[model samples]
Target: MQITPDGNIVFILPAGPLGSLPISATIVNTWIVMTILVVGGRLITLGMGPAAPASRWHLALEILIEQIRKQIQDVGGGDPGRYLPFIGTLFLFILASNVLGVVPGFTSPTGSLSTAAALAICVLVAVPFYGIADQGLLGYLRHYLRPTPLMAPLNVLGEISRTVALAIRLYGNVMSGTVIVAILLSIAPLIFPILLQLLGLLTGVVQAYIFAVLAMVYIAAAQGDEPGAA
Candidate 1:
């Protein structure tokens, strides 16, 4: 099975009628996912005015946002609204990337290590961003030097290691699912792939949920021990 989405060239765009740029399937598919999200979000809010009745899509979006906020509040134990946007985007993007793979000829960006690594890097940055926001920069930095100054290196190492683990975990699950189905398709050529594809849909959703929850936990933990910080 192909390990990276780069191997799948979805299309090429002409450059000045002289040369063409070969776009990876990952980039094309990512654009598709982003467009879907942006349009869906806009539509969901368009009908969600004081003068307008709530549509089913608006209601579903509210339920989802509230559930995400509840998760943040539970983990971080502070105002969830501050953290909701980042966490919600992460969940939705990953969910869309994985679920879209269920469609014929669509390859998931999350199945590619590059996409997974980029997301993990975002989380790595977010941990410190939220930590410094909730606590002063000095206050957040103190966590790295906790107990003793010598532990600082280990603490920093832990941070990078966990981020790497996060990327690998996400990429591995999505990649393995795709690989398994491909191999099974070659063998059965018909029915088992359909069943496995349905199972994969659930797995993809679960992976998205797990990734988001873990991200919330990481950010909340970094929010410091100060009152109202977490």
Candidate 2:
């Protein structure tokens, strides 16, 4: 029931060799999540025969991959295959990070503003990366001018503002949920907190979906088209 906004620092590099470098719980938990995903993914796809009837695990994986590919195709327009890996990874990572908080003794790395900002920054960078890849540099930058040259500064501001909004939106939602549950546990019965935790899981999944969708939308916009537009 301890509620500190920024997570506890679990390790610090000694100042004897270099200035002290502290690593917080958020970074540690992120590494844990990454390890889980990599190991789990490898184990799940270890063996597969190219046959008519696939294993249940393989079937389920295929379905998930198909759905993600379809969503990217529908939302991002140009070659879904190109964006699938990044978008799919983003969704899965965020979803896992969000749900990890429900485990006892585990706090979601995403609850920290720094983590959220980092994720948002990834999307911010990816938007231009994909855009520049799809269209040439001049073509991608041309969008900034839009209807006229006067709108360039406003467009730049809009990009910065949206990145900030993405970070704040995710950090505020995850942090508030954690804080509320902690406060309630101190004041109310355990059953209520349990129910809230379940709801939080659902919220986490939704947030992951929203974050992924928004990222795709930004990429689509940067590529010079509206999402879902043929």
Candidate 3:
């Protein structure tokens, strides 16, 4: 594994005679996470009938979905159902990416600026999409010029800054955790480093939660307090 300038560890797959794709750890791990989530989601839904036995996976998924909805409601986003898919997807994908870092030969895609930025960009694009969808283009644009048109430039800048902040925050925290653990392993007792890694796993969940919460807040702000926007 080679560390990139951004501090992400990456593995370059060997090229094939037939021009094989060059894959990195981030891409491979992300695909793995996505596949697992997809299959798990299918399995969880398979026994939805009341006559079917409830399993631990279904119970956990229920708790997660309920919590996501609760958080959305608490934010005054109204009718959490509409926002559930977007917010829930963000949390699950991020949660999976972060939590899976504990596996051997694995590093979180969130540790890469590329992946973090891509997720942030999704939120960035989603803001205006939801805003326009709820408030109409003219209505949404009007918010930027509120108080006066002179503030429009600053409002625009704030949106861009938010996206940057989201990307850096996720990338920095995950990257630092990986780095610190690596450093400790070299100089500290073996078991101590392992303990720290387990702690890092919890930290990963916290980071994912924070990112998801912030993204939801941003979306709600963009959507204003429209009852239907939720």
TM-score of each: 0.92, 0.94, 0.88
Please estimate how well model 1 matches the true structure, expressed as its whole-model Cα lDDT. 0.89
Clashes of each: 0, 0, 0
Please provide, for model 2 over 1-230, each residue's C-alpha lDDT reduced to its tens digit, 9 standing for 90 to 100.
44432558888878786789888888889999999989988777878667546778888888988998888888978688899989999988889999998897888988888889999999999999998998999999999999999999999999999999999898889888888898788789688799889988999999998998899999999998788975
| lDDT (C-alpha) at residue 106 in model 1 | 87
In terms of lDDT, the poorest run of 10 residues in model 1 is: 221-230
lDDT of each: 0.89, 0.87, 0.83
lDDT of 1 by residue, 119-187 (tens): 999999999999998888999999999889999999999999999999999999999999889999999
Once model 2 is optimally superposed onto the true structure by TM-score, how far is the C-alpha of residue 207 displaced, in angstroms?
0.3
Query: Where does candidate 3 have its weakest 10-residue lDDT segment?
Result: 1-10
Angstrom error of the Cα, residue 50, model 1: value is 2.2
Pairs of colliding residues, candidate 2: none
| Model 3 residue pairs with clashes | none
Q: What TM-score does candidate 3 get on C-alpha atoms?
A: 0.88
